[model samples]
Target: MDPLLILMLLAMGAFGGFAAGLLGIGGGMILVPFITMVLTARGVPETLVVHMAIATSLATIMFTSLSSVRAHHRHGAVLWRVVQLLAPGIVAGSMIGPWIGKQMDASTLAWFFGAFVAFSATQMLVNKKPAAARDLPGTGGMFAAGGLIGTLAGLVGAGGGFVSVPFMTWCGVRIHHAVATSAALGFPIALAGTVANVFYGWGEPGLPDYSLGFVYMPALLIIVAASVATAPLGARTAHKMPVRRLQKVFAVILYALAAYMFWRAA
Candidate 1:
């Protein structure tokens, strides 16, 4: 890869990592479209670009989530119990999601990604609280919710924070706690999703050089290195800032990205 391209990857990682720490997101939403654009520009087949981007994004999230979680843990914000409740279903759903994603055409996946992102952005902008505050759900309910989060995250190459944080907040968890917990949840989602993607794409044709199944190693390494360093910084910032305001800004960015994806898909 050109040194310029490497620098661009690093830049993307830095931005994504900062967002992850600040918002308790896995930064997959930010990474996926950018990675897809880059890969497509490099002459990768359209049919395979989105999968490779998503897989590589998930791979990077494994490291970014760990770094963000550690920072959140330092603040005693992570809810380990919630993580435990959600893990089993999240793992199961994540493992299956990439397999399903692989079967979709690139245009279809792009449309889905765009629509889902737009919805998330709307939710963030609305910032509507639930009509009635309730405690966290029963184990069965949590498991089912986790499954949904993991499956969506896997398909879109997200960290599951957009769904998890909002759901937790709606259930009466504090926003900070919800964000922190979402960071923890990202690890399992990314790990399982990445493993599934690797296996699912193994022996598939037309993958670019330096790929391990669907993952593009060069982009992964560069992004991970930059993201890990920046993630802690973002977490620190999150602790000092107004979270609601930050969320709104993040939502606006998501809307813009969604528009870009929609255009690309069309």
Candidate 2:
């Protein structure tokens, strides 16, 4: 990749990292479209662009999630109880997500990405309906939701925030705790996703050099370094302000990105 392009990706990484810190999101809404555009502009093979972006983005998230999770944990925002409650399901699902992804074609993965982005936009646009706390689902539902969301995250290279937040919120977890716990959930999402990308791409023919599975290492390096650099700032901001309002603003941004993804994928 060109040096200039690498620089731009680095910038995007910083911005995405900041957003992850501020919003408890994995920065997928920002990262994926930017990566797709970058790879497409460079005339990478049409079939490879989505796969590359998804894989590379997930690879970056492997680090970014840790940064944001740590930041949130430091602020006492992370709901460790919830993380524990969800861990078994999340781990089991996270493991399976990648295997299922290996069975999916690249284009199918892109479309899956598109639909999820659109769904996230729609969900973000809605008003909150606070459910009773007692209604929070137990082990079975946790496993089911975790597995499905994890698979989608692996397939699409997302941080799983788009699904995890709303699901937890609806399960009677408070909004603040839901977002905080979702930040932690990103860890499993990223780890599972990165691993899956490797499996799916493993032994496949004709991938770009320095790529394993769908990941492009040069881009991964730039994005992760920059994102981690800026995430703490975002985390501080989140702690000092009303994040729900921030989330609304971010949701509009997600809506726009969803539109862009539709246009590009079309």
Candidate 3:
């Protein structure tokens, strides 16, 4: 591997990790598109690029989420009850997400990813507050919401924060708590997504060396190492930033990433 490529992967991990901590995302929104770029440049088959990117991005979240949640826990911001309620559904949805993804062509999948990311960004940019009387739904409702969040996140290789954060806030959870809890949710999403992606992608032709199904081991290891290092820093920063400001900035970034995915699809 080229030293330059190594540096690029490391940098991606750092940025992704920071974003994860800062925004409660699993950093897949940032990592997926960029990973596509890297894999493309490395002469990976175009057909496999997006799938690998999504899989590798999700895998990294497994590590980044731990580092991020620890920081949030330190701040006493994590909502463990919420995590408990959502995890089961998230895992179930995550397991199926890759199977759906496997049925789609790469271009179609890219378009779907772009569309959802744009929607998520718009929601963040709008930053609408729900009615004061509104509150989190019952256990059944939460399971349904978690299932949806996990499915979409698995499809796009994200941490599910795009959906979870807004949903929590809409239900009257504070922005900080929402962010922390979302970070906590990333682990289950990543774990289930990773396993599913690997299974779905297993034995696919034209995979590069060091590949485990759709996951590129080299990229996964590098990104995880780098991301975990920076995640704590991002988590700390999230506490200091104004919620509205953070949302705006993150929204803009997501929009840019969405545009990139669209371009890739084209």
Candidate 4:
């Protein structure tokens, strides 16, 4: 990789790590678009750019989630019981998501990603509070919800925070707890998704050098190094920051990225 590209990846990792910790996201929302840009600029085939971006994004979350969740755990914000209940279904859904993604063409996947990002941004911009009387569902319902969140996260290369955070808040989980637990959940989602993506994308043609299935190894390694270093900082800030104001700003960014994805599809 060029020296400039390495610097760019490091910067991307720092921003993504901070965002992951601050938002209880896995940082995929930030990483995926930028990774797509990097891969596309490197002359990767359009057919493989999104796949590599999403897969590599998920792979990084496997590391970032650990860093972010450790900070959240220190703050006592993680709900371990909820993580236990949701994890099994999350793994199952994640295992199959890449197979589904493989069936879609690059444009279709880009469109799907664009729409998903737009929806998530809308939710963040609105910041709707769930009804006070609502509460988390039974174990079975939690599993089902986890399945949905994991599947979408796998498909979109996100940390499942966009869906999980909103769902948890709706179920009366405190916002901070929701974010923290969602961070904990990111590990399983990324692990399962990465495994599945590898299985599905292996032996496919048009992949660039240093590729591991759909993942680009160099980006993964460099990004993880920088992201882990910044994630704890972001997590600590989350305890003190005005997250509502931050979310609005982040939502606008997401909207812009969504527009970019649409343009990429076109």
Estimate, for each residue in 1-266, the C-alpha lDDT of model 4 and write its tens digit.
88888998999999999999999889898889999999988999999999899999999999999999999999999999999999988998888777788999999999999999999899889988666567888889988998999899999999999888889988889989999999999999999999998889899898999998999999999999999999999999999878888889999999999999999999
- Candidate 4 at 87: error in angstroms? 0.3
Kindly indicate the candidate among 3 and 4 with the higher lDDT.
4
User: What TM-score does prediction 4 earn?
Assistant: 0.97
How many clashes would you count in candidate 2? 1
What TM-score would candidate 1 get against the native? 0.96
lDDT of 2 at 39: 80
Q: What RMSD value applies to candidate 2?
A: 2.2
Best by TM-score: 4
TM of each candidate vs. truth: 0.96, 0.89, 0.95, 0.97
Model 3 lDDT per residue over 31-149, tens place: 99889989998999989999999999999999999999999999999999999999999998898888888888999999998898898788879977555457889999999999999
Cα lDDT of candidate 1 equals 0.90
> Candidate 4: misplaced stretches above 4 Å?
none
| Alpha-carbon shift of residue 1 in model 2 (angstroms) | 3.1
Off by over 4 Å in 2: 99-106
Best by the lDDT measure: 4
- Pairs that collide in candidate 3 are none
Which scores better on TM-score, 1 or 3?
Answer: 1
Lowest-scoring 10 consecutive residues by lDDT in candidate 4?
A: 127-136
- Tens digits of lDDT, candidate 1, 211-258: 999999989999999999998888888889777887888899989889
